[model samples]
Target chain A: MFDQLVAKLPVGICVVDEQYRLQYLNAFFLDRMRPDQRHNYLQQPLISIFPEQAKFLTRRIKSVFVLQHPSFSYWEQRAHIFPFKSSRPITGEETQMYQNMEIVPISGPSSEQKLACIILQDVTAQASYLMAQQELASALKQEHTAQRKLIKKLDSAQSQLIQAEKMASTGQLAAGIAHEINNPIGFVTANLATLKDYSEQLLNLCDALADKLQVTSPSLAQFSAQTMDTYHYELLKEDISPLVDESCEGLNRVRDIVENLKQFALEESTGWQLFNLHETTQQLVKLVGAQYKAPVYKVSCNPPNLQIFCEPASIKQALTNILINAAQSIKCKGFVKIDIRATAQRVSIKVIDSGVGISAENIKKIFDPFFTTKPEGMGQGLGLSVAYTAIEKHKGKIIANSNPGRGTVVEILVPVVHPEQRHECAEPLGGS
Target chain B: MSTESVLTADQRDALQELMNISMGQAANSLAHLIETKIGISIPKIASVTPEQLFSMISEQADAYYTRQSFLGDIQGEVMSVVSQQGLCEVGALLEYDAPLSQTDIQEIILELSNILAGACLAGLSAQLALGTNLNMPTLFSPRKANFEEFQWSNSLVMEVQFDIEISSFSMRVVFCLDDASLDRLTQTLDELLG
Candidate 1:
């Protein structure tokens, strides 16, 4: 009964003697062998029947016999040790069988008759499943990394949108205040000019009367001189004209500043236009230099008087914000250099400052809206963020490089003509 | 001190001789399996506190560790420490291919521990006419704090080192017997001396 059970087992089992001669083969092993060699295989060496893996097989069998312990071989290391086809070759995906073999030492009735038993199990399906799982895990990991990068980009874009909204509201408020101030400035200038004319005409009439009185009546002349001395008319006459002129000059200055404010806030003509970039940069330097007198401002433009097609106000505003930041960074004395280099394709504006530089930790957050190192209420921390948005609208890039206690250099690059504008320009020419 | 005095000098000497013979057999089995000459140091026997045992085993760095327990006439655990250096060469000797994977290295460590520990236990049991069964081996990493918290104060430990001639591969096998097993082992040594 035991012999019958061993012959019918599903796993392939075979026993070999100390010299590796085949002693026994169960039905499972015999069914896969050639019928002609089956009868003679009992007394032959195990390697003679399976010569493909002869080296590995011999080593394993010898090890089991000598060590008196089992030795294992998996499909991962050596796929197939025997010349066998898959059990379900007709339906299975694998063309050849994957196997795991175990060799254990067995003792016969006599001490000299030591033998080793070989057990082979098919594990094709399990190995295939594990490999598929590993491939899927790696694919998921790659997708997770890509999604993390996309999320970071979206986070930055959201903050930029918020900063743009804040600037829009501020611009609207300035526009309203500029319109109200223009009404009062118009009448104040006209009334001051009329009052100056009236006073000058009355003083001329008094001067003629005094001359007539001196010539016609000597007694009346004495009385007139006494009255002039009593009223201090000479001092009044000297100070009156100069005071009116100074008041008018002050009013004109106020009007010029309000006009600049209106132009800065105006959104009309936001479209692209050909601009003299050199003139714009020089004006910016003059404007900021007047306010911050300590910093020595210098402007250098290569290929002098280069022109670019961009929104004039926005470009001026972006440069203005950067210049202000540079000026404020100086504690005592420093210089702010605006270097404008223009190529046929793009314009590069580098604002270099010799002032207190930004710290490493704060540099990364500088572009983020509302991220400020300044004391509360001193700054809204929207200067760089606004500049960033303006540059982005023109499809440009802005970068800042700084060394603490040394200085900071901000580089801005804007294409001379945007890609969409280039396409539009080519369309009309093509049609013609 | 109490645990130290339990074994007489004659009994200690007799046990050491018996351990030497068993360790030789263990090394011989591995040498024959790998077709290479193997050398072993003289076996050392001592009664040690838990702290001493932990220090003795955990001091070696860059080594793979494994433990297997045995049952029957005596109960004890066997711990094996194999150096990580030159393990690829040793794996080749055991019929494993070059550039061993992590799994392949793990399997090699377990099998090597089982063979040496099993043979040593078998040789010792055969000499004393006692039956012993060894459980499967598993990887072990000991922490000093955990070992110091062990309930057993002292144990009798037997240690031996095996060195392969062709390779820099070396391993140390430490056998620790329980309190009752230690008494049984001493009695068995005395009987052998008689």
Candidate 2:
């Protein structure tokens, strides 16, 4: 009964000797073999029967014989060690059988003869199911990574859109305000000049009348002098001219501010042309220095006459904005150095300032519109953002590095726009 | 109360001697098979809680682990910790090619554990006149195991180490018998002492 059960077991059982020659094959193994080989396979070398897996099979069988212990081969490492077809060949997805082989040392009844028993278990279904699940898991992981990258891209693009929209509307608002202020400034400036001349002439006429009255009638002159003394006429003559001069100066300041607002709105006629970077830096230093006198400004350029093809008006405005920030960053005394270096394809403008630098957190949002650290009513916070927009038009970028209280370095990297590509940028550089 | 006290002084001494002989045989079997000089250290016997067992085995960061179970006159499990250093040299001596694959490395660890553990068990059982059969070994991760939830609070453990002279690699095997098997082992040792 035990012999019958061994021959009829579901698992494949093959007995190979110490020499790895076949000794016996159970019915399970014989059923998978060819009809001719089934009867003749006895006494044949196991390697001759399965030459492809000969090296591996012999090594494992040899280990069992030497160590007098069991040796195992899992389906995960060496699947389908045997040349056997799947039992469920018609319905199974896999063509070959996945086998887990175990070779254990067994001694014959004589005790002198040693043999190894090879037990092979079919694990095709389990192997296939695990592989399919692993594939699905890796595919899901790849899809998740792709989605995360897309979400990050969308977030940055959306923020840029918001910034562009804000800049467009602000540009229109500035243009409108500049127009209204321009008219009043124009008339007020002209009237201040005429008032200055009129006040000077009236003071001279009063002086001449007082001298004539003193010579014409002595007693009448005496009464007139008494009247002049009561009114403090001598003090009035000395202060009148200076008052008119100061009023004219204040009016001129109003006109200069209105001019700047108009430039901020962007002039529609500005076009791409060759502009000298060296000269622009000099002009910018002079202009800002007049207003902020505390910070000493310095300008340097490589290849002294480096002329880059760009929109002169907008480029000037961008530099003016950056220089103003550099000047304002200083409270009492500091130096602002402007360095312009040009490569074959781009020009780098570095503005280094020895002033209170930006903090780490606020540096990121410096290009964002209305992001300011200034006290209320002191700054509009549109300077750096407008500069960023202008540089973006020229396919450029700005990098700011600051050490909180130490200093700040702002680098504007702008691509050199050649005149040949001017037609590609047909749109007027009116509103950045 | 304690695993050491579970056996009388004579039985403990007998058991310790038996363990030394078996471990020496195990090291000799492996050295003969691999054609290398393998050294064995005196086996240490202890009774430990789950936490102690975890700390003892999980202390090595760079080691591969395997666990096998045997059933027969006594039932218990054997855990092996193999150092990863100089494993490739050992693999070459075992007729494996250099630049071993992931599967090759795993197979080496499992096969090496099986040989040492099987030899030790077979030798020890033979001395006690008991029959034991060892099952296949599988890869194990001590970090992932929840030692606190183990059913046994304390168990007698026989620990031994095998050092390969050809490389820096060393293997430590720990044997832990079940509660019922411990009683059987002690009784068998007593009879042998008599």
Model 1 TM-score? 0.70
Cα miss at B190, model 2 (Å)? Answer: 2.4
Off by over 4 Å in 1: A30-40, A48-55, A74-79, A83-86, A93-96, A162-258, A265-293, A296-344, A350-411, A416-432, B1-21, B31-61, B65-81, B89-104, B125-194
Of the true interface contacts, each candidate retains a share of 0.34, 0.52
Q: Estimate each model's TM-score.
A: 0.70, 0.75
Question: What lDDT tens digits, residue by residue, belong to model 2 across residues B1-194?
Answer: 25556677888889999999888887888888888999998888888889989888888879999999999989989999999998999999888888999998998998889889999998899888889999889999988999999999888889898999988999999999888998998899878877
* Candidate 1 residue-wise lDDT, A299-410, digit = tens: 9999898788877767776888899999998878999999999888888999999999999999999888778889999887878887887888788999999999989999
In model 1, what lDDT does residue A146 have? Answer: 94
Q: Candidate 2: misplaced stretches above 4 Å? A: A1-8, A27-37, A83-96, A148-198, A218-243, A262-432
- Measured against the native two-chain assembly using Cα atoms, what DockQ does each of the candidate structures obtain, in the order listed? 0.26, 0.45
Tens digit of per-residue lDDT, candidate 2, span A225-337: 89888988889878877887887787787666556555545545367888888976785676688789999899999979799988876677678888999898899999999
